[model samples]
Target chain A: MAIQREHELHSRRRGRNVAMGLILGGLVAMIFAVSIVKLSQSQSEDSTAPNYVPATAGASE
Target chain B: MADVSSIDTREYEAQFGDYVELLKPRVMRLVVFTALVGMLVAPVPVHPVIAFASILCIAIGAGASGALNMWWDRDIDAIMKRTMGRPIPSGRVQPGEALAIGLALSGLSVMLLAVFANLAAAGWLAFTIFFYVVVYSIGLKRRTPQNIVIGGAAGAFPPLLGWVVATGSISVEPVLLVALILIWTPPHFWALALWRNEDYKAAGIPMLPVARGERVTRRYIFGYTLLLIPVALAPSFTQIGGIAYFAVSLVLNVVLLAGAWRLLKRQESDRDADNFRAEKQFFGFTIVYLFVHFVMLLVEATLRAFDLSITALPIWF
Candidate 1:
């Protein structure tokens, strides 16, 4: 029997690889975004309370 | 061109779509919708980004559980007419691949929820997955005719988890939504089981219609639909509901009861002639029934958020 010219297996592998790349990239971006949001949220909470100055800031050595 | 069977078919590989099929995207849509509604209707306002992220995590968790279910149920899936074309049973994907995908996604979703949301929500997500895959799928499914009754809780958890994600604690409102799904499940599933009775029987599964007899199954479905009325209406008593919710629930419950009553009268002769038309219709409508309830909750949330709600104050806690 004559084989089909199309590399169906290789084509599927290539598509899967491309999809994996896209998903991984998206996940990395999402994690970065989440981290930024977490940091900003904590910072805003800190800003809401009274500001504190260290005792050593004005003390002479 | 190649003779189809002459190609080196042993090296056949699954495409990306097969992997996606393992996630059960259709079911994930329901999870996403319910969870989103559950989060939005909460008294606490969540950050938009956090809300989006939380919904995505919940969806991933649902997908993971679905993959796990497919992996475990591949045997029975192959035997069932309904599920014979699934990725694993169709030989498009391997069981180990499904197991790995399920585990990996499950861990990723839980970790993300813990970091971005709260530990309580993450723990709930983990527990939900465990309940579905281990408790329901492995332990109860083949063993008992009451499997659907208990396993239904697995599907009911997403909304409650969403509420927890937003509020960082469990509350009466989300629990009511969970109960609503729980009440809706057996009837919806049994309706399908009634029509697909032979499939379950051939698979040696103990679905209600197969084990309890069709008449009994119909009665149970009717009973559950009757029971759905109060559980579906419970949200109206809480701060979660508005005027639209009450009206929608009242109307939908009546329609559902009417549908159930019609289904209850279904006989074997009717089934053989029309292939359980009433059961099929009842099953389809039950899906719509649950969906419309949640959609009305969203509508009520919108009204309450704008201070346009008629029933602005709850009559009781």
Candidate 2:
């Protein structure tokens, strides 16, 4: 009975540790995905050549 | 069904499968599918990797809502024949454990969605969870006859949330998609309610057929079905849908309308063991109806994405 109780305690501790690891891993993945999206968005914005229509080009005289 | 008093968590140890059961995988599949349609139909291109991550977050959020719903409804669940085997009610998992998992997954899903997609998408996901878990499951469920009508919004919001995640904004297209689901839910659920009236009555849950008579519920089923036809067709006229979608919608809605008509024409006295075939058939068809329309939308979007002009509507349209 004592050995059984010890085994249960060991399993519970392992489960807690695994849960903590998953949470930490998810946080890291979230940060990484956010960084990639932000970076890609900024790069796209920068790459797009702005249309600079001359102010007077279409003005009627 | 075990009496709530007789449920003793100490008798059963939680298994890995119990946690999966808490997610309500069947409902999650529909949620994920609709959300995927929302994402795919958006005008802006989403990177496949980013899209995958966003969808995963949405799925997790939906699972969280299911867990929370099970937690909140565990008592009524214990009494109902249909829900007797759910994790909490079956005594496989403790209520405290379910609640903790629900809350944990809820926060994680929301934050992950916000980071991977836009905050608007995350906000909508958070609201969807809150609406399902709190507003529908807890607040309106036991109190009103119109519970399913309002509660339906929680399920409808996923596609719109998906659209917002992809585009980082809301638009008429997504709103129309949400509207379609919103209108469709009543007839869908009410049909099930008609079939499962005894379970609901036994649980003292005020479903339409329980609160109102089956006759009233049947009338509502037809009325909502009539209302749904127009909403289902609305998307075809918009920028999102084209000739292919219009043709699909026309055929599907007419069949759906006919199904409703059959239900309406059937007498309430016909709800005997041999004759709920109409109800069962309508309930089954409604699921197909929603899925087909959304899949057609995805087809239209894909056609447009590839510049496949053959399926495109005429220039005048």
Q: Estimated TM-score per prediction?
A: 0.90, 0.86
Per-residue lDDT for B66-148 in model 1, tens only? 99999999999999999999999999898999999999999999999988788889999999999999999999999898899
lDDT (tens digit, per residue) of candidate 2 on B214-285 = 889989998998899988988877777888888888998898889888888788677574579989999999
Residues A1-61 of candidate 1 have per-residue lDDT tens digits of 5544656555657889899999999888888887776655523223344433244232111
Clashing pairs in 1: none
Every model's DockQ: 0.26, 0.11
The alpha-carbon lDDT assigned to residue A26 of candidate 1 equals: 88
Q: Which CAPRI level is candidate 2? A: incorrect
Which candidate gets the maximum TM-score versus the true structure? Answer: 1
* Candidate 1 stretches greater than 4 Å from native: A1-12, A42-61, B1-10
Error of 1 at B87 (Å): 0.7
What candidate 2 gets wrong by more than 4 Å, as runs, is: A1-6, A9-61, B1-11, B310-317
**Which is the leading candidate under lDDT?**
1
